[model samples]
Target: MMPAEDLDAEYPEDDWLSLSGIQHFSFCKRQWALIHVEQLWDENYLTAAGHIEHQRVDDYSESELRGDVLSIRGMRVFSRHLGITGICDVVEFHRSSRGISIQGREGLWEVFPIEYKHGTAKTIDADRLQLCAEAMCLEEMMVCSIPEAALFYHKTRRREVVELDDSLRDTVRADFQQMHQLLSRGSTPSAKPSKACDACSLRNLCLPELMNKKSVSNYIEMRLHEFVTDD
Candidate 1:
């Protein structure tokens, strides 16, 4: 088992990964590499809507105190051990007995990261892993233990709490290591079509249908032969 402190050690900034890509990596490794490694992106309706929603949350310029909870919007976070960096939508510092002390703060506060999603919760653990990654980063930064965090879904208008357990953390560590390896190789994985592909923003670019076909050249040759035979 990798020690928590070992994951906190800093790496070169140039090689830092995006914490947001955790969901993409969990959903599909090829999709993550295509966007993060190859620098390719195609925004569809769902993605466009999600971007807008996040923009609204990120645009807030100030943090505020609401009763015992101090809400910080658009918090920038990074973890050297994970070699990932990204912005959190909202991080609430709630007053608690078993919390860490903040500089110049009056009371002990526990950190709670809240992530915004444009859709309802899915059976897959992509969003949960993403939220857990943020909590991990916060844990490293603030030197506090965050047992759980919440995910707010726009479609459902509900917040779901996720517990950051040992199994989840181990999966996150392994996924990030695989992601780094994939980056080093600098090669996109072959397209493997699944039910999830239909909702992917890169469907057209991925060409899942053609992926199963013999070859692009063969497809073109067959089409040309049919055209010639008709004439």
Candidate 2:
């Protein structure tokens, strides 16, 4: 395993990956590479709606203190060990008997990161893994133990708590390693069509049907012929 401090020396600052892409990469490697690697993106209803929701959360001007809890919005976070950087929607520092002390603050405070999502909780752990990644970054930056975090879903308007367990942390680290390897190779993997493709914004550009066909070359040739004949 690569040590945390050695990451900056190993990887250049320009090569740092976006922490949000972990969820995309976890969903589909091809999608991740298409967006982050090839720089292709198309916003469908879901993604556009998601952007709007995130904008609302990010537009808050200043941190607010609600009694013992200090709610900080749009908190920037990065982990050199993971080679990823991104912003959290909100991170609430709650006063606790056994917690880390903040500068100029009288009481000890426990950090709790909250991720805002446009959709409801999924059966899979994609959202959970993303939240776990954020929590890991927080732990690395603050040098404290963050045992859990929360995910706020727009559809449900509720927060789902996620425990930062060993297994989840292991998964986050392993996924980031895989992402680094994929980015280094700079080769987008072939499309693997599934029911999930229907929901993907890049389905049209990916051309799953044509790519999955037995004769991809023939399909391209036929399309070219049609274009030429039409002109």
Candidate 3:
């Protein structure tokens, strides 16, 4: 059997990384490493709104719901031992009735983690990966088996359930490794311009304009050469 330490090693944290790194890793590895590892940050209206939303989620105290379910809001959880840490928006515990039997064995309650987002559903799987990272943190901290989690989008006004399968686990592990590798190497990824770049709060600092200008200039130079050669 693989040692638990090996599993825990996959999640490593230093002053260079944050609980937010999980979200960053999902959005863009280069962007992720830049802000967290390189300390480059620029805030815009959208990011400001997201910051407020996270603050609201992380400010509440622990509580229970419906008497039978225990709920923890804005729970600050981190396992340095596991090398991962993040604030969970809400963790709902569903307690099975005492003496309840399943398959001739006593059954216990389960944990279901729900993360709230201020945006609509994204085309990328970053949101799902973020939720999965939270579940991994929960499993490590609480020593419980959390097979799945859910993402609640304010724009969609709905919840999307995500399974914590091997694929996601592998993604989380690989991302953590890649982030650490970039930080240790002190390397930042090159800018990748996309329509999504327009929406990023760091667009200005990231210099999408400069990059686009360079791209256009290069294209013009190439076209001029081609036209002159055709004469």
Candidate 4:
């Protein structure tokens, strides 16, 4: 068995990373560095709407029991190994024999974490990655394995089940390690604009226009080469 200390990956409380930042990190490292590293922000309608949605879901004191399942809203969680802390939008505890016992609760209960999002399901794994990170936090705090979690999209009004596969878990771990290194160095990476930049809330503040601009000399040289080749 691994030593408890090594298993936990514990860090000083002050050094804990924000679990929500995982989504932004996965989407774009430069964007993550800008926000989390440099403390910069430029929110548009999309971000503001998402923020409102999150605020609505964050009823931390609320928990509902129905049948054999208990659902908790805005449950705070943390992981010692990942050195991250976050809140799950909703975590359902289902009664089961192969689960852990909860304080003041009867019988064993399995955990199911759910993350709420503003838009429809994304083609990228940004949201899924964040959900996986949240599961890691819950697993560490509860001392159990959360084999699966879910993403609930407000726009679609549907739930997408996510398997906590080895690949995703590994990525989550690796991403956090990279994030820590970047943060420790106080380095924000240079921007590389892409199609995703179209939807990024930080597009204006990130100055992708300047970064993407081609030099006049280079443009003229290329045009001359094209003209000569044609002749």
Candidate 5:
């Protein structure tokens, strides 16, 4: 694992990956590699809706202060240790005597990051990992400990609180480390298609079914055989 202080010298700015890609990497490594390393993307309804939601959250002009809480939307953050960067959907700083001091703010403020998702919560831990990654970055940046965070799902209109346990943090770190390794090799992992593939925006682009074929000729021959059998 790269230490926070040595990350600059080790990973450097050029090696930094997208912090948001943690969710993708967690869900499917091949998907993350395709998008991040190969620079490929395809937008379906899911991705399109996510973009719309992200736009609203990224409206930097939408910040508000209510009571003792200051909510900043689309705040940019990065983790040197993890070699990742991204924009937080919303980070609420609550007035707390034990929190870190923010410029132009009267008292110290405890940081709480909330990630907004277009769809409702799922059985997968991708969303939680992403939120935890954001919180980890905030912790490093603010020099304060954040024990928990929240995920707001648009579909269910639910705010799910996630505990930043040691296990989750360990996974987040290990995933990034593995990402950096894959990126250095410039190799994309094989596709592991499952039920999740049905909802993947890059289904067509990835062509998971054809990924395991030894060669294009073999794939063509296989397709021809299938066609002949159907006839």
Candidate 6:
């Protein structure tokens, strides 16, 4: 087992962010800042569809019992240490012979975190990173080490195993800390135009076109002012 401090030091800049926040941060930092920091929200068709899907999952009354294990649905989790909160699509808890222990590390408690994605698998790592963060939160809250997690894509009807390794954990941690720092500073960074911008919910409000205009304006100002002379 790796030491916690050593694990933390391995990623000197990694700060844990909430599992849900990962997707937001990846989608668009400005969107994340406007929503999470400024507490703004608007419903579009995409968001509406997503809300319907999440509402189904958030309805935790769908747990099933088979033999000694119970499959829970739509469980919520939060970490004050990480300074973020989010909900898990599902959490499976098995009936363990060993009881929960504080100091005792040896026990049989199984925890499986399954995150439900509304669409097909993405080309980005954000989805998997979010799931990994969820696993880390579960480990911290349950006092057990979760070695792995899963992401269930509704479109693909499949699950992908997510190893709660140091790299991903460090990423989540880093993003969380960075987000806090951003919020504390009370200023949004310049728009970083990416292909993901096409699907962002706040594209209109963010107006990358306008930001690009400012960039051009600054460039032109610098070039034009370079030859200016005072009389």
Local accuracy of candidate 1 as per-residue lDDT tens digits, 49-101: 99999988876576789899999899999988888899999999999998999
Give the TM-score of each candidate: 0.89, 0.88, 0.79, 0.88, 0.88, 0.80
Per-residue lDDT of candidate 3, residues 1-231 (tens digit): 234566645443443345668787788676786697678898888888888887766656645566556677887677553366777888877767531222322345577888888888788878887788788777776677788889888778799888889888887776766766677788888887778887787777777556556577788999999999999
Ranking by lDDT: 4, 5, 1, 2, 3, 6
Q: Looking at candidate 1, what is the lDDT of residue 98?
A: 88
Q: Where is model 4 poorest over a 10-residue stretch in terms of lDDT?
A: 1-10
The true-versus-predicted C-alpha distance at residue 26 of model 1, in Å, is 1.1
Which model scores highest in TM-score? 1
Give lDDT per model, in order: 0.90, 0.88, 0.73, 0.90, 0.90, 0.72
Model 4 misplacement above 4 A: 1-8, 214-231
Candidate 6 lDDT at 222 equals 82
Residue-pair clashes per candidate: 1, 0, 0, 1, 0, 5
lDDT of 5: 0.90
lDDT of 2: 0.88
Error of 1 at 209 (Å): 1.3
Model 4 clashing residue pairs (backbone) = 8-81
Runs in model 5 with CA error above 4 Å? Answer: 1-10, 211-231
Off by over 4 Å in 3: 1-16, 80-82, 97-108, 212-231
1 against 3, candidate with superior lDDT: 1
Model 1 alpha-carbon miss at residue 58, Å: 1.6
Worst 10-residue lDDT window for candidate 1 reads 1-10
